[model samples]
Target: MPKGFQAMTPHAAPPISVEGLRRSFRGPDGRPFDAVAGLTFRIETPGTIVSLIGPDGAGKTTLLRLLAGILTPDAGEVRLFGRRPDTNDPEFVATLGFMPQRFGLYEELTVWENFKIFGALRGVEGAALETRFRDLMTLSGLKGFEEREAGKLSGGMKQKLGLSCALLSEPKLLLLDEPTVGVDPLSRRELWRILEAMRTRTGMTVLVSTAYLEEAARTDRTMLLSKGRLLAEDAPDALAQTTAGRGWRARALKDAEEARLARALMHDVRAASDSPAAAPWLDAVPHGEYVDLLTAADHTRSGTPPRLATDAPEAHLEPRAPTLEDAYCALTFPETRAVHAALAAPARRTDPPAPTRTAGNPLNAQDVQDAVVAEGISRRFGAFTAVADTSFRVRRGEIFGLLGPNGAGKTTTFRMLCGLLAPSGGRISVAGVDLRTARSAARAKVGYVAQKFSLYAQLSGRENLEYFGGCFGVSGRALRERIDELTAGGELARRLDARVGELPLGAKRELALACALIHRPEILFLDEATSGADVCARRAFWRRIVDLARAGTTVVVTTHFMEEAEYCDRFLIQDAGRVLALGTPLEVRRRAGAASVEEAFARIVTDARRRNAEGFAS
Candidate 1:
């Protein structure tokens, strides 16, 4: 142990206990909005990991702030270790570590400087501080980057530094808010490993909030929240059991066949009110070669809807085990199946046109021509090489994904492609136009959505969209027409006049996407566009993306969610500024000998590390 550390006595009180907690805020309409309304729960175990899982605007952040004593509750009571916590009480506050979503680290300061400042603020000094610093450096993989400025680090490294700063004092209770939101899978796994090790060694209680439901499985217990209320709290397995018998998988022989069957199934569900046989099924979504279906567990007994046509000749339906995400969807959105089908209905009807092929001319072959191409792309900053000889091609109307671990040069390559960063070496082309000659013209043909929210926070959503539209040369009646069309049916319509800063994370994401499409460019570039969106919002966003692709819009996107890669036609995986693997999702999985895309990514990265280590030894 470092210093001022005390082990919890065997009979010590629980780390946290809450009773009738309630918090409300005034909405844009001047009406009271309950962020955390009448919530009641307790953390009885010590040294265990607990996760708060929910959609955007679900009150997870509010509850965390309340527990940290940063915000006083409007009503009810909260006890930390059987005592009320006071923000002004230094001794009380020192017992906990709170890392909000936006950690306050000076951008100009080096990593070591930030750590030292945080340590001093926590009143830790001398050997105790040094010892803690060394431990954190090793655990967070930040030892070699201590001299680097905080702003220069990649997204993943920045998060690691933030976490290291938070753990400097070794508090008994650690509170983290969405620590893995924009982080890649490899970094996310490493962070979890560090957290698990810390929990086991120090017996510290951890409470984290996350948007990814799959992450909840790693926690000792998961609490489900919605609209500022606790819907359920239980172990991962227990929650999965709630939707056990309702899960089913349907497989077809080919992609075309699968698509046809999926459409048929959806049609059956939508017309179920008239057709009793289809009424039993709740939802169906395409999963590669197969379609996953969800139905009421006791539909047969309920008799309100007849059983599905599982024996259909076009496809094969088999009962499948429920996953944590499946259970979460069932519990949180009971109408998820219908909602997904409704959102996807448009894309199913108008599929994108297939790439045309030339019969005789090899130069004009469909496979040889591409909308975007990069050959021998590289970028250097003084002595450091940020990108190295990266090459890839994106065909017209293809959903091409760029994936990599943090600091792997994804952003650098993305910037070069978008003309924001001039490459040190390479040739680039967009929309058959050479970027070297007509970069401005090429940029004009594409739309870009940045990784972080970039719109003016003070402006209303409508004003922001209108401004972006005008910047894209869309003015007069045309600009107004575009804005009205974009926000007509979605969440943006409801909050058109609300300030961008006041919107929820998901709503803000929607607004950014809408702004990017104001001019209807031929190509779209998105960098983690769905980072903070909820499951429903992500589904809706993808539906629109598919529609755009079908209408001849080429899409180049980067994402941390492994499952989202399924939507891509092809993807490129990079590491250490070099391409590690490039192929379709299934091809990459086969090369890595893995079961899923996530597993395949881990295998490829592990192999890359081994090769790099051998090169260093040689």
Candidate 2:
């Protein structure tokens, strides 16, 4: 038995219990603010998985840290197994395992070395440590890679290794903080599989925080947090029942028709002021030529409810079962849905129709040309190839996705397209300008939003926009007008005077995007811009993207969220610096023989890895 386990005491209380938990910090202006304010909750059952769901600044991480005994709460009582959770208590500490958002792994050490260090730290030694380490490696799919350096592993593999380290002591409870934030679909599934197996075999309790609602649904129970307050806590299916009969799907004959139907539905919802009890439109998510809309049954001024229109001439709407995502949206953004409806209405009214090529029109000929083209693009560092023979084209006013796991060459390709890195071989063109001959001219027509926040933290949001506007050659009165235009009627307008560093994660991402679009470039590149954003933030971000594409701005984006690919006209999948698949989302799914883009991506990468291993053996 482990040394710490000998000190542990049995209790008849719940695994976790908390009351009036609070934590505060100093703001950028040296003012005090509360991150977690008077939260009360309990985990009553063991051997079950619970999920913490909330937006960017909802105090999920703060609560986790407080429970781990890493940070002292300002005012609260936290009990683990009926005793106070004190880091100084060996018995209390030995019962829990915590993995933070950023795992601190020694990059220079091999996989096996890292495991040994963690195991020894937990007081496991000799034969016990060796047996535990071997079991972990086998369970995490890292048995063959024990000799590989930690730094050389991919993002997914590193996450798995981190989980193994957290589980070395075999604690009764595991606490994970957003473990799948930027991981690929296949690896994400694998991580969950390992967690589930641990629970089944050892009856260990698991609590995880996540931004993906789909992932939250897989847990036994979900606790929704907002502004550090527990709004609701219940089983996943029971929570989803809150918005039943409110989901609807609409299919159109063509892309243009789908856009038109979406606009008309928005107008109808806006115009129906008589129905005061009706829920606002939840979402207008687009999938190729179809758009799925979610809304509640309309209640008239007399309190009479009316069913949804399923046989309308404009669209074919069918009632669908509610999902965890729908329930979450209804709970979090009940009012913000109106804001989206209003924002999308005017864009549809003013946007021009798709241009058709004509024999006598010069403008039509120019419109037919591709906005971005890459032929045989390749990048190499010494003897290792980063991106190899990649080719893809983005037409004007289209959304194109570039997707792959980390260390899969997606970033390398993105950098070459943005002109941040030079390609070793290829012909690259942007907005009808050749990059090799006139790099400046080609760069001038593009806007880039990096994966991480790129702004002066100390500066105000408005100031950062002004600075970037001037850099893009918009100055004097034009710059001021553009800043006002971008911030009008959204969250940015309310937080213009706040410093960028002090703002919430969602607000910071929105400001970054506004800065990138200051000059109104013809093309845009977004690299994981929605990585850590919440459901509401992601919806607003995509609405802005759709509006930009409607106004003739070509978008090239890379994201880990597979659902986002449904909005793209087309996308390319890459692995190990080679293109594995390229087509519409549905087409790619069909070719991979999978139901969704996420599953399709996993299948493609799994096959590629198998083929590579066979080649090496030969």
Candidate 3:
């Protein structure tokens, strides 16, 4: 038996305990804010997997840091196995394994070298080190990539290597902070499998934080946090059952009216709340072909679906089995729920269309309607091909998705399309302008939001917006007008004067999108814009994107959330720098014979890997 499996078996005490935890940090405005306020929880069982979930700035990360002995709480106490967690205690440190949101690995080092270094730091060396490395590499599917440079590995591979390093010491307690963020669905499943297997073999306790509610629902226990307080904690099923009667699914008469219908439903719910005889608070969001509705528990409409006022095609409402997300919304404040639903509300019918080339144009396209076109595009760095012979076209006002597993060249391809990187071969055009000969002209018609926050952190949101608007040549009255248009009476308006870094995850995301739209460019590029946002924030973000596409702005986005792919009009899937699938979401689902995009994505990627190992042409 391996040392990791044997090392954690002798201990019998509970892995974690905390009471009245409190932590605070100074905001960008020089004001103190409680990050983890009066939180208390205990995990009594060994070998249990507990999921920590919350919206942005809900103190999930702060709680993890406090438990890891990296941060001292202003108040309250934490006990690991009935002893205080002290950073200077070697025994305590050795028994705990922590992987932060961004795992710190020497990017320039090879996978084997990185593993060896982390092992030595954790006191694992010689034969013991070799055995541990072999076991972890095999389990993580990284055995063959030992010689690969850590920097060159795909996102998924990097995550696996990080996990292996964290686990080198066979710790009894493992802490993973959003370990699966920004990776493909296939990689996410593999990571979870490794976690489950590790717990089974070693009886180690695991605490992980994630934005994916469905992922949290699968854990042995889930703790939902909001505003630095524990809102609810229980087994996943128990928590879900709390919202049993609040969930409903409503489908529009026409499938294409789903978004519009959802907007109308939410709008009616909000408006009714302000009237003399208003209905209870309700949340509505578009879900593929239908609109998902969750009503607050009200005896007036306890068992029957509430009627909503809307000009959209009549919708049929049916009861939906409640999930963890519905439960989360139920516990959240009414203001938060209102903000989410309100932001996603559709534009007023009296408003003018956004200024874009494709506005008022039909979906059907002739050759001249192509907003973006790439032919046999390829980018090679030295001997390695990042993107190979990729070809695709984006129609005007269309939402096109570029998807693939980590390190599969999605970024490279996206850069080529944006005229940020010169492809080694093939032709490309943006907004009818040739990228090869008129790169500057092509770039002028597009706006890009990077995967990471690229705006000035110290500057106020309003200042950042002004700066970006100036760069894009919108100034004086024009820039002010644009800022007002983006921030008028919503979440953005509330956070506009605050420093950008001080804003919560959702507000920061909104600011980023607001900056991207300041120029009203014909094309918008978003690279995982909603990667860490909560469910409500994601729904709000997509609603804005759908509205953009409707007004003739071409949107090219890359996201790891497979369900987000369903929002794309058309998308292409790539792996190992090769195009494996390309078509509408329904078409791809049919090809793989899978029920959901995530399932199809996993099946397709697994099949491709198997074929490659069998020496078949990819």
Candidate 4:
């Protein structure tokens, strides 16, 4: 064990114990709704890792705040170390470290300065503080970058820095809320290693909430919540075993056909069942180039399983081991199916209106032309080159993806494409207007949704839509019509009048998309649109994007979730301002000699970095 954590020891009581907890908040309609309702659970072990998971609005955040003593429960009891928690108690506060979804780090300060300040505020100072800070920097891989400003750090580095600051006090109990939401896969692995190392060395307890089920499966225990109640709690492997012999993988499926196959399978299952109890499949969801199907117990026992109706000679089905995600879907499919049915209505615009040119732009709207063109584009700041000699073409109505690790210049390239930043060199044309000559006119033909929330928090959803519509030259009856078309009979329609600040994370994401689409531009850009969303929400969001692309809207997107890269017609991968690979998903995987996009991405980036280091040494 390291000397820094040697002073820590396991507590006598379990880390957390809750009994009949309940909390409520008023809705926009002025009615009370339970956020955390009548929940009971206990963590019986003192030095174990536990994962809390659920869909949006499942009260995961509320429950975490309650356990951390940041919020008071309206009904029952919450105990820490066998005693009720009091936030005002210094000793109690010293024993706990809570990193909320947004850690309050001083953006203007240097990384080292931020750590020193946080440590001193927690009563660690002088040489003792210096030793602890060095240990944390080494653990977080931020040792050589101490002078970097916090505001300028990459997404992964910022998250690592936040984790380091949270550990300065050496709290026995750590609460992390979605710590890896927007982080890259490599950084996520590093964060988990740090957590595991801490637990193994010092016997500290960790309670983390995550949107990624794969992360949850690594923990000692998993607790699944839904609508403020605990639906299931058990070891992940044991939970997965409950769905044994029912999981199947579909082979020989194509990207464009996967969605249609899933929908068809759902429809056939519903039609084949005369009664609710006669359904043959629980759910069918697209997983990359294949589908993951959860067969009904009775269907599997009867020696017959569902099959796809396709002419492909190699199409086949094979049994696969169940996973934590399979268990989660099995437990929640009935309720989720109903909610999805309600939300999927507005996104089913298969024959949407054709693209129209923005007023004052002379470009002809055609499906065959290249929607975005860049030739040897580069951007440099002071002595550093952010993007260098990059070139790509995006076909109209195509789904093009921009992919890279944090600080790899993907955002810089995206900003140049959007005409938000002028390139330092090279030629670029967007929507047939030369970006150098008419940046504003080119911007008028494209709609962009940023990586972070960019809407008015205090205004209602309808008001924000109205505000953005007017900015795009839409007005009065036309603006109202656009809003109606965007929200009619969908999830947004139900939350239309709610303040943007008060809605759930998924709802907020959808509203941002609506605001961006108000102008009906020829092209759309989405940056990490579903970074913090649950699996169901991501599927729904992609469905909308797919339909839009089918209806002649050119789409460019950037996401950290590698699985989402499969949805792109073609994608470009870059690192350190240079292109690594650019091709279809199949071509990229073949070039990298990997079976999946995630694996290909890792292999590509690792190989590039290794080659660069070797060249430098030579």
Candidate 5:
């Protein structure tokens, strides 16, 4: 048996296989939006995770649903272990496990109860059910609180329970739809651990859809779904190799200036808009944002978007490896607004440098102070000490990140930071406003995008903004102006009048961020706001966030991607509700002696866990 991500004995069979699949959804006006058109993929080896990556409304969910036998595609073929998937094969259905983006389980049931009921539904009972329950409980790290009601479980735990339930029958096929969206980084890793473990153990094939490009890159193979069609399908490495022969990075202007550069490069004789940038790239010459192909000597002018500069010492150059992210951008032909703007001529800044520090009273109308402050804060739930004395702060114009493992108290701490729950003890302020004096006022000074698409799905983007603006007391011209400002610019502006519910997952998230920033709050609290979005959308969303941060809006973001951690000015790692490490991302990783920020967080928590054990084990 594999015992890692998939466990399959010789008795095991191929878990899933699909052929020429097609699907569509009813548009807002009742037109058909072909989501998955003529898609084809196979799951031959058990325990291999295959991802369907694309923009939202790309039919990822539809494909998964079709495989789960929950929905029949308009035209296609699917088989689970050599049997047609949509047909009712009690044995196959019983053996297939699915975790939808919105998985449904009885909210009132205790974790154990839900597990048991699911087990029973699949006809596992008596000692077998008990044993399965015990194994799943441990595998999911769901011990010590089997009695915790489902309703009481955090988002991460609930999803874990859903997964455990899915694994209860030991299904030969597993399907997961963006299960780690709002889950903290630590939790996200733990979930992956379980995923890998299951794959290594069962040899059961797992097919999943994901918003994280890194996740897609890690999969054995991937399908790039675009507006109802299969854009590409191949190994991630092969996909990246398409542009691997020529790859380089060049420094461009920052923010609005960068936008200008991107726009200029977009129309410039070649190339178009790409997405997202943080930190600075090495200065290059010919002295434009793009790596002008004509500027490059070896360049064959094929349809391939030309590569930027590398090793041009006169260009103050630095060479780096091409990333899967870069490959995705290239293959997808992502818009290069950044490149375009980078190519534009520089504009001199006549004004002198502004003051480096600005502090205002928490009660003042001008929130010119630091974005967030925390000191010796702790949270406790009854006898359980969730978060211990944690302290960190974020200055204006910085992207501050918070990371931790699952069950590490990241969410608990977040709730406290958001004032959704009061800290058991601590001093905290947000956007120069003390959370205690007037929570609403403090909240008003900050923009927040929750992990879930909590916006009114039924409302059009315009109507939703109006209502949310009303909550902020913006009316008449002010409200309209604010709304216009939010939905302004590139892709999002085009969807202002579209129904929020009808928008793709990526568009909805973008709209949410725009809505949160409608009032131009001094700081933005993005609590895992990019989790279930499709790849292109996620990139576009991040581009917007970078724009916000560069515009001097203090941004505090929580995310599962380590690469994203690179964007932050600094970060704090939390585990079991305690701050374990704090510093610049590079510093923290160096201190932890780990290769990546995620690895550093794992190291810190491992150290903390060891300390806790030794301190208490007598």
Candidate 6:
């Protein structure tokens, strides 16, 4: 920004301020668990979006709950509208809206009915609520389907309705605990749009917790958390600026393909690691680079600086433009590569053990695949088609993803596949077992992690896992062995006896996964499983899933994080219950023809919208 432009920036007193807040929970053995040591922050405006970000075990959710007065802080104070958060003032609580990580909507009630109860709880009724209800349904794209039972709604739809409940009263302060967790990319985008629109119109004070850096980018300011500590806090633009001039994209170089060279220098680093998990390309630093750099003979490389000859001809340097991703990586993991290098057993990539791919006839693609084939699947509530003519296949051992905006057919598809809902139109077969015909057997062979942690929180983590294992037919010695393997020496095990509800969001997520995988199902379905956990937790969860897949588990996942598409062996992009595109990571990226999965997704969605528009015009 120019000097004059900087002068135009707004400066106002914070609408909410927190000082030295801390929280702790008692362990099963009566030990006090210090979750949040100390946290302090201030939000200046009602309209601004403030994000609390951190790795697993960070105090983000604890702090948010404390501010919402849902949980009492062990120490210090949180003030909203200059009053203590625990004021017990109905007017004060009414001025604030809080959405928990696990929302408490009545699954048995219709979407509109659930919203009505929540609105009534907040003291809004009659005509005023009717107006708000209409507005929220439109904002959520559930206008025609409000009469549909919440239990019958898709995961994304449930989340949207949860958001709508929070917004019905037009609270001055909004606390959203990972509101977009199980939503598809398209749905996430719509949610962002609604939040932005709400912000622009009401100047509402919005605070959110997220594991995604992309979501953080949407916030006016963000606080990075790690292990119950605050690492850094700053405006998005300022944080991005710190990584200026240090990032690039590089592909292979060929003699005849010189013309394809872009501004970034191309090189081959044989010694460098190449793991999808670590993103070797994105994380590569030039300190130990070995390459054949561009010379005066290569005019194809764009914006090349003048080169000078030296005694050694092995190295050439190029100035590259840094991106927000690069900046975020650099700031968060400045010596990440160096730290990895210091370790003697450093692998170049985040490669898991090789997958134990089952033996099957390659020519018989349709046979022996651990897949969910949903044919002619359709769900209807009254006159609305939540899912119509939806059909798809999730291949064996492939990390298949469902991508779409919110209120689309993603959740409906998942339910049909899992036999949670009998489709109005068709059939779902899992690993050759038809769900509608053999629901129990089909379900037993499938492991699922819901968008929200479904394990009982009041119970111990270990108990939850063991109980879930039993539900899936694993019991006695086998269950014990599996539990030991999942929990032993792992962080999940270390927190074994801890009450599930008392654990951090990340730990809760890990426990949920442990439960899902307890039965060693051939098919796994994760519905936005990593939505609200910290970055470290998200990383940990992905690592575990990759491990599970390598062990021959067929994983089907739904996520709002576009970057995760790179992890999928193949992915299907959906918008409004229709499959827009489907292919491998590279294929999808190439089809979208963009730098990263995030960019490709944006471009693909835009193209999809354009095509829809033109078709309608015709």
For each candidate, give its TM-score against the true structure.
Answer: 0.87, 0.88, 0.89, 0.87, 0.79, 0.68
> Among all windows of ten consecutive residues in candidate 6, which has the lowest summed lDDT?
262-271
Off by over 4 Å in 2: 1-11, 28-31, 253-280, 287-290, 296-313, 334-368, 615-618
Write one digit per residue (lDDT tens) for candidate 5, span 490-555. 455667677787776556766787678767767778887866654444544554555566566778
Q: Give per-residue lDDT, candidate 5, residue 477.
A: 98
lDDT of 2 by residue, 483-511 (tens): 87766666667788899988877667778
Ranking by TM-score: 3, 2, 4, 1, 5, 6
Candidate whose lDDT is highest: 3
Q: List the residue pairs that clash in candidate 3.
A: none
- Model 4: per-residue Cα lDDT over 1-618, one tens digit each: 223433224655667889999999987678899999999998876678899988888899999899888899999998877767777777777778778887668889999899888876677789988898899999889999899999989888988888888888888788999999887777788889989877776677899999888899999899999889999999999999889888887755444455455444544343222333466665555565666777866667633456554422244577778888878877765545533433343332333233344444444544116788888999999899999999999988788999998889998999899888889999787767777767886788788888776989899999999988988899999899888887664567788889988877766777888888888877898989888887766655665676677667789999888878877878999899998999987778889998788889989998999999999999
lDDT of candidate model 5 versus the reference: 0.66
Q: List lDDT for all candidates, in order.
A: 0.77, 0.77, 0.80, 0.78, 0.66, 0.65
Instruction: Score residue 390 of candidate 4 by CA lDDT.
Output: 99
Candidate 3 lDDT tens digits, 31-143: 89999998888888777889998877788999999999999999999998877888788788788999988777899999989988988777888999999999999999998
Our model 4 lands, by Cα RMSD against the true structure, at 4.5
What is the C-alpha local distance difference test score of candidate 4?
0.78
Against the true structure, candidate 2 reaches a TM-score of: 0.88
Residue-level lDDT of model 1, residues 481-578, one tens digit each, is 87877666455678989999888776677788778878888788999998876665565466667667766788999999887776677899999899
Per residue, candidate 6 scores C-alpha lDDT tens digits across 1-618 of 111112212644356887887888765567887778787877765667888766555667777778888889888778786767763677876888888876668999998789789877788999999999999898878899888998877766777788888888888889988777655666677778878777766768788887667788878887776545677788876776665444443333343221112102211111121222323233432111112222121122345433322212233345555444445454444323221221111112222222222332121335335476777788897888878787777767667888776666777777777778888987677765666556786687778889877889889998998789888888999999888765543445567888887775556766777788787777888988877554433433554555455456778888877766655767787766677788766667678777566667778877988998999999
Clashes of 1: 0
